[model samples]
Target: MRVAILGVGLIGGSVGLAARQRLGAFVTGHDPDPEAMRVGLDVGALDAAGTLAEAVADADVAVVGAPVGRIPEVVEAVLRHAGPDTIVTDVGSAKGAIVAAVDDRRFVGGHPLAGAETAGVRHAREDLFAGAPWYLTPRSGSSGVVFERLTRFLAGLGARPQAIEAATHDRLMASISHVPHVIANVLVAQAAVVLADDGTLPATGPSFRDATRVAGANTTMWTDIYLANRDALVDRLDDVVHRLQTVRADLVAGDAAAIAGWNDAARADREALLAVGLAGGTAPSCELRVAVPNRPGVVADVALALGHAGINIHDMTLSPSDDERTGEVALWVDADGASRAAELVAGLGLRVEGAP
Candidate 1:
């Protein structure tokens, strides 16, 4: 497979490196900054660097890694120059706007939940996305062939690919990721104001340090992200403010029981949320074989169904019949969910059975 990375920044460079080193793909890159392109090539993240059109001319997949603000325009250019069969995706955190902007069936909105505190092409690593959740936002009308190809490629790169609606992805990110960043920034600003009068800041404990870790990260990139998902972010922010007001009321009333309950509730909520990722960790792993007919959107429909039902696919492989009229998809999932996964696949009018 040939992959083209449209921006050779940290995420784009990592994607290139993973594609080349892991999948042995011919990875070409194009960056608005020539220095990023040069460094990307020097770091072995790319086989070559050139103009956007040249890079994507023959690519099987083209990933737009530009900043969130520029993704729409870059994706438009990528689609215009890429081959008709080339699948186009992006690593932008916000997917709703980008997906709506691109009306083509070949385009799939994606955001990998992987990154490093350090930035730039030089810091890119092939294993950055290993064991990470890579969300793919594909509409119902999106091409199943493109979605399947992208899913297989991402899996090869050691990333877990899951299908979700663009709007749902945006809302989840707004609540979990964006709102935390905002809180971090606000905490730092408030601390600065409180310390200004003393003319010297006191040492902070881990609580303060950890809470403000993402405080002022990549201002330019984050500005675009905040604005891109403004509506969702605003709604979440309002919820945060209302919750804070309740806390303030409890403190003002000196309600120790309410305070304890609030603190314990936070701990419980955190554990519950984290458990979602660790659900099948202790369970034995198994595979389910699904017999499906060769058709457009069939793979995507089944994949999305299982994903929406909260079944995690650890690995997958597709085997087509000699006549290409039928195929079987082998899905590796935790033993605890294998039976349910088979049930879901079977409900889709496909033949599904567990691998004994």
Candidate 2:
């Protein structure tokens, strides 16, 4: 099936790469930036870059990986052009606005929790989505075929499929991804003022570097996440403010126990979540695992192999590695049905490994 990706930036370029590896799906992208298009074509991230209509025409999936702000318009345009059975998706950070703009039953609001500090197609890499969670928010009365295809599509890309309602997705993102992006920007602004006060600023260590690394992402991109999820962001922002005030008050009081308590609680909560996340079996669908052949199509090969096995995959994630030949595929399937799936996959002559 052909897949069209509009925007052709990092996200759109990534969708192309994933389609290649997961489904061997024909991949095309659209972007006004000729240089970005050139980069995608040069790097082989896209089969071709063309006008929006051409990109989506007869495509099985039309994905809009544009900026959060531009997503609504881009998605609506794709909705108008999509084939009758085309599954349309957008990788916008904020959901409320875009979902409302394009409420067609064929549409699914997707936000893959993955990205690097870089922007543009030149930075596009097939490894970007390894082990990431690709969320899907289906509109009511939507065609299940599109959702099923997307689930497999995301699985083929080595990402876990997380189904969420649009409203819930927006609220969750405000607390996790969107709000953090805004806070990163605000913190960077604060750091700038502090740096200006001194001739030399202290080198930000790993913690600060990690915290603010995303702050350097395109401001125009972030502005959209903040605005589209404004209501939820505001709620999350208030909670953040309260926590900040409490921390400040504790510091002012010189209460070591209070500070320690805050740190201890945070560590406990985070560690607990990590423990569960670690067990997601490295793939979105637990039923199938894709063995990526270090160089490319690692994801697609795995998905197709599993599909051929007729295994009902729940979620999947692939292990990250620098060696293109040593990719690890993790499949999530029932313990009772796992051996058959594993044996069939191992027959492919790929080193098939699983959590069970």
Please provide, for model 1 over 1-356, each residue's C-alpha lDDT reduced to its tens digit, 9 standing for 90 to 100: 99999999999999999999999999999998999999999999999999999999999999999999899999999999999999999999999899888999889899999999999999999999998889888876777668778888898888888877788788899998999999999999999998897788889999999999999999998999999999889989999999999999999999999999999999999999889977733477898888988877777788788778777677777888999999988888778877788888888999988744
For model 1, give the RMSD to the true fold. Answer: 2.1
Off by over 4 Å in 1: 279-284, 292-296, 318-328, 347-350
In candidate 1, position 301 carries an lDDT of 81
TM-score of 2: 0.76
Clashing pairs in 1: none
Query: CA lDDT of each candidate?
Result: 0.89, 0.74
Candidate 1 has a TM-score of 0.93
- Stretches off by above 4 angstroms in model 2 are 198-200, 282-356
Give the C-alpha lDDT of model 2: 0.74
Task: Please tell me which predicted candidate would have the highest lDDT against the true structure.
Answer: 1
